[model samples]
Target: MSEQLITPWAESRPLPPYKGVLAVDAKDFTGLPAVLHAPVSQMIPELVDQAMARAGLTSVLQDKRFPANTGDGIVFGFDPAHLPFVIWPFLKELDEVLAQYNLSVGPRIRLRASVHVGPLPDEGRPDDGNGTPRNDTHRLLDSRPVKAVLASSSEQTTHLAAILSDRVYEDVVLGGYAGLHPDRCIEVPATVEGKPFAQRAWLFIPSPSGNLFRAGVLAAEAPGGPAEPADAPAQRSGRSYRGNTQNVREGTAVMGDVSGNVSHTSGDTRYTATNQHWGSGDNVSGTKNTAAPGEQR
Candidate 1:
């Protein structure tokens, strides 16, 4: 006989409806001194509550539906219709909240948020929000594109780095419903470490930080502490060179069919982008005969 496809409890409950999912996690939470961990962890929800109040999302918080904490962060599952609200006022309000908190508090608080929409069956949902959508939500939150946005930026200036699923990006941002501008978002590959997951996603940063800021007098204070040249290569998404190719950002990173080594000056490390897909393949040691992926140097 074939194995049962329907579980006993699931058969009785009506199908769960698709829902909007949003998650926020602190950057470098583990880097804090152990003593400050408790106070910091305790503030995640309180700050969220304050943001909700500002976004007028207090009703959902009152319902306390699908709220889960992932040690250093929190997740909220809600009706898909509210996704736009979460994307706009909620995210903006949260960014403001974090900026204020970091200014007045010790152990600066920076965050990475992910927005997704999917079903969370009543009975089958994991206790800590481990459904596929929420899992993907976390994967996006942990993805390097988003992390690089935060990492490459100044923690004091950059408050939040948010990732959006292609669906949400289309339905909310591109649909002209979100306060987030379309041009501000960059497409990226959303993947997880040690996990079988890959998808195209979008990234948004509310405030400019480090190397991502627009060029101007402010550029001088950006990550590298200097303004970039007018002829610098345009920023590319995901890994470098569009393949296993090395992107020579030192002078010219123009894409080509041939493989070559790349080098940079002392301060040029700021321009050298680390490939999130297969790790950094930059040949900065000033040597010939670089090894290919998985080969001994």
Candidate 2:
């Protein structure tokens, strides 16, 4: 007999809306695929499992309620209420584990992850049918700001660069639950094709010393002297973002595109994209996907 579909919280049963969505990607995945892909491909799932366990949330994996799948990376959902306990711990452990794995192996393993809170498909519903907040979370991962953090930190002691949407930062992180301070968050814009001002998120780098949310800790520990200011605009090839300079770089890094690569420079690694401008605006066009969240009974 065919196996029955096991729906967590029940099929068509009222369920609480997903409080947040998290997306992760291996850095420079295509750059050194020959050397890194095989090992990275093998370790991602193990890291995910360990991270979930570290957060004391192995049930989310067993029950299949979280719907986390790893391809080149991973994406998962969790209750916003668990932000302090669940997601933070997961990232903390994941960072350490990835560091350990990289040390044990030859090549370094780094990740770019994003977190956003919004409505998502209800339990038992199909995610592929709509773009949902989950996709938005992925878009944030592709944003230049996030890539900038990851790229610039390539030569540093940091291994993970995480971006939190403004909503998540303002609501949860700033609310004082995760022990993450507001000053550590660097604001940046995210623009998607056809979507103006499509991206706006905050970036945070996890430190090797285990102080995940402390600003400047990673830079201090980095081999290179003090890096860019925590709040400096993402610096691209020939330009930067500041006041009304208009001398900004524009680019688009489509989500899930294997061809995309992060460009590295002597000062800071530049983000690869179709355009080079990183300006402020909500004037761009194009609609993204979102799901009508469900309420738990």
Candidate 3:
């Protein structure tokens, strides 16, 4: 039940918006088996190096592990747009290579991306160690618009990934506990051989980091309506709302016997007997002696 923590990848570094350009927070990794709880700390660094080498991007990155307060692990970050197009192919290749180690990419190891078109901030060089610049308020203000966009993108990607991946993949989306919101979400139905698949869709959550978490799977179904009304009578019994008695015959009262047998009785005399168990057998009984005038029977 780990959740992801959201923090600025770089402190005091201004990020500006660019059209058709994306920023991604990516981590390099080889797959590890589920039984191994502690993975090599060098795994992320090695992956990053491999990505940089393949993309031919000459950039310096800090080698520090930012530990979570809860002691889960640390998160690494990089600028995706700074890397060459080969970055994507490199990751795919890494996945194939790691398969040999009986490890692949960790499910939780994903990139959050953000794409925006806007102006970037420009940082000035330091002066003669005097009052050069107390703070880069200019860059901070300029990067605000773009930074906000990227933050939103990361949230959307995380949410979509959570919904699409299998239940086991929850570890990835949940992160180490800081819940994020998803915006600009899109769900597309999945198909096989040009035919629709039942309860399946493709989700897209574009992060400012230029990272897109993609997966294919079945979608969750909506629950059915409430349970049927409990007042419904049993189907086996042919009794109506007025009880088992079908048609009224004079002043007879429809009585149900111990075995649920229905019969008609007028006063102290049984007129007809109908045994439902015997398939509708009716027996005519003797009628009560009619009392003379007002005399009681």
Best by TM-score: 1
User: Which predicted model would earn the best lDDT?
Assistant: 1
lDDT of 1 by residue, 1-297 (tens): 965566676556664667788888899999999998888888988898898899998777775556877779888777777788888888888889999988884788888999998777644444534468878888899875678667767777789888999989998889998777766676665655456666778877777664454311022333544333444346522223322233222222222222343333444222232221211222222223344564322
The regions of model 1 sitting more than 4 angstroms off are 1-15, 123-130, 214-297
Off by over 4 Å in 2: 1-16, 34-39, 63-70, 192-197, 208-297
The count of residue-pair clashes in candidate 1 stands at 0
Q: Is candidate 2 or candidate 3 better by TM-score?
A: 2
Candidate 1's TM-score reads 0.69
TM-score of every candidate: 0.69, 0.61, 0.24
- On lDDT, the stronger of 1 and 3 is 1
